[model samples]
Target: MASTETVKVKVEFGGGTELLLAPPQDKRHSLTLPRKDAAGTETNVTFLIEYIRKNLITEREELFVDGDSVRPGILVLINNSDWELEGEGDYVLQDGDEVVFISTLHGG
Candidate 1:
């Protein structure tokens, strides 16, 4: 039998994105997210983005979030591929999938 309940995923940070979080800059996270949201919608990268901001980021939320999606300069990679190729925020998560947030923004 198959299950749509897979929840374990690996989240990673890069290109100074880690610094946006609290001290220690752990750089990686192992999380067990809900397969379906409270509204019974399947969880996706958009959900994961909010989850990181709410659960992991302790400050500078503007640097990480722009509304419900990541800030413009942040690139989201799902399983090493660009998120645009994987349905952006609608990509359904699978067990053991790796998600990476890399900041390509810099101040002059």
Candidate 2:
């Protein structure tokens, strides 16, 4: 069996995305996730997204997740850099990395 190491990261929500959490008020969280996935591969933002959807999101999952990544209109930032510059969902998380999710779509 492969040993699982944990990575700790800070996640923040904004642009109304904070309202999607269970409490709907807590927008920041320090999360611990396995460094390796079940397949014994290094985990990435994709894994983290699933983790948040499963463990943090309480309802209206569609608002947060669309398939394997976040739904359209949600911007992702890693360590203050646009996730697109960091390879988006493919970026391997580092300890203490700051991940921010901001939703750009909102009801008018």
Candidate 3:
């Protein structure tokens, strides 16, 4: 089994909302965010990429976008560059890297 490690993710919203979301206590490989628009909705984001391998070997890996049950609109960015525009699940994350998730807000 791979030794679990914790990664700090700073989640920010376009509407000036920010939070320091961490992985679950038991599994240091997943992140979950609550759905703001959907009442009582939750989303689970996981880190399946080989973080340690990438750090030791290559500096980049194809990024993947994944979440739990919720279907909220999310925009992932690294160093202010949009990951989707670059190619969904094709970006690389590094040590001490900053990953930001921006939630989409919908109104009547």
TM-score of 3: 0.36
lDDT tens digits, residues 2-80, model 3? 2123334343334211221221212122322222213432211233122322221132112222232112455656657
Model 3 CA RMSD to the hidden true structure, in angstroms: 14.5
Residue ranges of candidate 1 with Cα displaced over 4 Å = 1-6
Instruction: Give the local distance difference test score of model 3.
Output: 0.35
List TM-scores for all candidates, in order.
0.92, 0.92, 0.36
Candidate 3: segments with Cα more than 4 A from true spot: 1-72, 85-87
lDDT of 2 by residue, 12-105 (tens): 9999888878884688999888999999878899999999999888889899999999999999999999999999999999888999999998
Best by TM-score: 2
Q: After superposition, how far is residue 6 of candidate 3 from its true place, in Å?
A: 8.2
Reference-based lDDT, each prediction: 0.91, 0.90, 0.35
By summed lDDT, the worst window of 10 consecutive residues in model 1 runs over 1-10
Q: For all the candidates, what are their Cα RMSDs to the real structure?
A: 2.0, 3.1, 14.5
